[model samples]
Target: VSPKGARAASAGMFITLAAHVAAMAPGTNIGAAHPVSVGIAKMDKVMGDKVVNDMAAYARSLALERGRNADWAERAVRQSVSIHAAEAHRLKVVDLLAEDLPELLQKVHNLPVKLNKQTVILKTQGVPVHIMEEGLRTRILKHIADPNIAFILMLIGLAGLYFELAHPGVVLPGVVGALSLLLAFYAFQTLPVNFVGLLLIILAFVFFILEIYVTSYGLLTLGGVISLLMGSLMLYRTGDPGMAVAWSVLIPAVLIITLFFVGIGVLILHSQMRRSMSGVSGLIGERGEAYTDLNPEGKVFVHGEYWQAVSEEPVAKGEQVEVLKVEGLKIFVRKAS
Candidate 1:
């Protein structure tokens, strides 16, 4: 029985019609059993027609077995027709109309039901209907199965792993990423995830990381953004809207993640391009005082240490010199102008 303000559409309609005693609350509506396609792959007209015809036949059979309106059931499958509870009862599409669960139980009580070729009357009167609660594991799984939540987890995992890889020894990001990624994968087991979308998302991250090493000039970043957007939009393959990511989450997530990865890539590139600060290369172009006079050879004090130096021109003692190049414990120098 449908609750108030609820609907029994698509597969719900089939379930309702197939019941021994179909029911609906006063504000509820039913019908609209047309099959919808949500996959990237499209069904041809012929195959589509066959599926629709098969469903229509099935709906008609259920209606006939329950002695309801077979024509309406067929129309619900073929034309996606729907009706309110009162109208459904008028059309003989439903066996009863109930205001609530208690009323429904009272109304369905003593109803004749055929079981194993034997007619059995329902004894719902004073029969406590125990509502089974979802187990903790199942509840958590269902929560994680949400497309947005799963997508967020996947991104967090990727970002964490990327951060850890970029800066090794940052143990927190790696641990978080690994855990989030594992959880996301587990959630994917329950969701209708498209492999193409998953691949695109992974490819996007690859591009983001490559942007740091390769001279793409933002081309890789742009590609990553496009891939991420497409991946987010096509993450879930389902006819049900509830199973897909919401736009509110997708838009901000894509922008934020893209910017974050791009920013990290830029920083890496900048740091790589910067000059060395603490090696022999750092000694080049340093000014120093001659420690001893020499005929094109002398000792110079540079960077707080004395080094053997040879100059193209003669340099006197106490004369300042500039280091040119370093070669095996010796430094080439020129007299300071």
Candidate 2:
């Protein structure tokens, strides 16, 4: 068992407990049941004591059941203790310690093992080894557990929802957003996500939307960006590098989203400030000549075409008029000074 890489908490503790005649290679490790590994290293005194006591009892019981060193197991849970393979074997925490598998098999050959009230002899003459192939579902689930993939899912979900909200009645964005959010949440179930961080991210989106209606200048947007960055930083503050959101993903994502939010807000604001150039708006400020007496309602030639023009004061034919507004096809105008 090369436990050389990292494994801890529930998976590590439970799997180690189930091992029979467990062996460890050099530079390998086992036995980590600390509650602090659950991302609450700074838990308060009373609660921390209770968690430690409970985990210690649980680990000790598992050790006793497996006929392993119960004292060391309790220490593993309470004090977050670890030891090298040589020490582990010397302490009988593991049955054997060897440099590699061949050495381990040779050392353990014919070693007596107690099997439920009977001693068993090892049959290690020439055991054929068949490696188990990873199933497709397991492989896919493994990939889904990646923090980078989860982060990408979150971004995709947010972008889709943003598009859907900005352009309502577009079914694609809403559908993609819903699915991506669900998948992201599924991934989050496996990840050590800080709820406050998740909430801050949501708040950032809220602020981004508020920039459109609330006239806080760009302050709300700046705050939103800050919230996003802080939220991302706290998203996986659990100390474990395996569970952390990558800085590479974080920086680029923040920049892209900041630009996206600001760009969208600017376009909308610009459109609102610019003169209307379509529909009834297109006729506003257009200069035209009255073709007939606008006894408040008559035809006027504007933009090289005739339009039904209306004015409060009477205007003579061939008089220059400026369009003030448009109601349906009727052009409201005033006589030019």
Candidate 3:
């Protein structure tokens, strides 16, 4: 049964036809039972025909058993045809049409349903309908089970981990990353995950990280992008659209994640290559004023503090000197030219 403005398409078509009394609400549509290929490799013409024929036969069998339109069922599977509620009733694709659930119940009250060993008549009239709501845990599991949600969670986990690794002191990112990864793994247990695709995604992250150390001139980043795209395409091994990540989700996710990894890598590399601004190394090449007269060694003020300084030549009092190097508590200096 399909609700108003809803459709019984693809796998839903098969289920609808198998019902003892198939039905559609006003403004609803049905048909389009074409089987989608979930294989990583493209099917050849002959193999494609075989799959279509097989699916068509199954659809035809279901329609015949339910005393529906077998020819329309076959056409639905083979040609991906669809029909509105009124047209479906005219074509015998559906047994009845109703405005709502109550009307449907009223219509199917005395409808005959064939059983394995007997014929049964429905007693739906005046049957009070009680809708059961999903529990919190069930709702959470349902959201998590979605391929798009799982994929996003996995990406978030990777991004968090990447941030944590790049800057180790950040505790929040690591914690978030670990939790997201756990959830993603839990989802994977129920999802149809392709291990090869998983490996490719991991490899993509590796490539992005390598960009920071190895100077590949964007080659590594490009490879990472390619790997990510391919992995996204092959992630879920299922023909069901609900089980697969939508292209809308995939495109944005890939672009955003790729930029994120590469951007982080660039920031890290820049920080590593930049000159130090603190400690002894920072004092080198700094000019300081002589605080005391120096025959060969004296005190000099540098970076707002006094330091022991040594000069190869004699320097007078109140002279400015340039620090060349720092060793322990002493700084090698030369008179400012």
Candidate 4:
């Protein structure tokens, strides 16, 4: 059995326990089939204790069924100990262990086995080996479980949603974000996720958005950055070392997220200080020519558009004037000095 830790580890351990005759390859591991509670603040320790007890019981039962030393198996479960194939076979933890699957199968072929209290003879001397293939869902779930892929999907989803919010009329980003979120959720369903950590991540995004809306003297932005880092760190909590996110992924993700938010924050700040470039407000400070004499009201041509105009000073036709304010269907203008 190749049980490590987490969901697959538990399932693999259960499968191994169900086998009539079990043999492990050299250097193979077989312990720690327990779920780690993630994200739950209150019940984590309780869940850990329950899982340990349950796994220990299961290991003891399996050891007893296989006619192996139950005490050692129980101890292994309790202490999360894994032994080498040679040691396991010598200690009777496994039977007929071999360096490879073919050798193990050869040794087990035509051997007498007891399963579910029934004795049966294996007709496996010349039988063909059958291998099970993973289904589509399993394959996809495996891909999603990859830390790098999940991280990338998260970034893409966030970026898409941000783009959609910034430009409401664009439907692509919304669609992409929705799909990405669904994928991310599916991945999370199979992986051990900390909801509290996820909430912190969402809170970080909220803070970033608030920074854009309200100039907070960088306080919100700084808090947002810290929250984002902590959330990313807590995203996955598998007890197994192999399943955890690699430092390569974490370092790059942190750098990328930091740069992305910093760039966005700077852009937002710049936008806040920028003058309007669209709408009637845009017309202010723009010079125009009076098409007709303006005592208080007349017509002016600006940017290829004719507009009703008014001025405090008299302006002759074809005189250059600057727009001061816009009123209902008319513009207030001042003669160019």
TM-score of each: 0.76, 0.78, 0.75, 0.79
- Candidate 1 local distance difference test against the native: 0.88
Candidate 2 vs candidate 3: which has greater lDDT? 3
Tens-digit lDDT track of model 1 for 4-77? 78999888999999988888888888987877654334567899899999999999999999899999999999
Model 3 bad stretches (over 4 Å): 9-14, 26-65, 68-93, 114-127, 167-171, 189-196, 242-244, 303-307, 327-329
Error of 1 at 297 (Å): 3.1
Give one digit per residue, the lDDT tens place, for model 4 in 1-337. 5322212134565566557787776657565554555323334577778877887888888878778867777766566556666676788766756666577678988889996778898876667879899999889889986766775677678777987998898999988987887777766666667776678878887887788778688898889888877887877775644555567887787677767877887887788789888888888888989999999889999867999999999999999999998887899999987
Alpha-carbon lDDT of model 4 = 0.75
Q: Could you tell me how far off, in angstroms, the CA of residue 286 lies in candidate 4 after the best superposition?
A: 1.5
TM-score of 4: 0.79
Give per-residue CA lDDT, model 3, range 1-337, as digits (tens).
5567798989889989988888888888887777765423445689989999999999999989988999999999888898999999999999988888888898889888889979999998788899999999999999987889989998889878988998899899999998998899888877767778888888998898888888999999999999999998888876443567899999999999988877777787889888777899999988889998878999999889999999998888899999999999999999988
The TM-score-based order of candidates, best leading, equals: 4, 2, 1, 3
The alpha-carbon deviation from the true structure for residue 82 of candidate 1, after best TM-score superposition, in angstroms, is 4.9
**Model 2 TM-score (2 dp):** 0.78
Candidate 3 residue pairs that clash: none
In model 1, the clashing pairs are none
For candidate 2, give the lDDT of residue 11. Answer: 52
> Least accurate stretch of 10 residues (summed lDDT) in model 4?
1-10
User: Local error of candidate 4 at 52, Å?
Assistant: 3.0
* Cα displacement (Å) at residue 126, model 4: 3.8
Listed per model in order, the count of residue pairs whose N, CA or C atoms clash below 3 Å is 0, 0, 0, 0
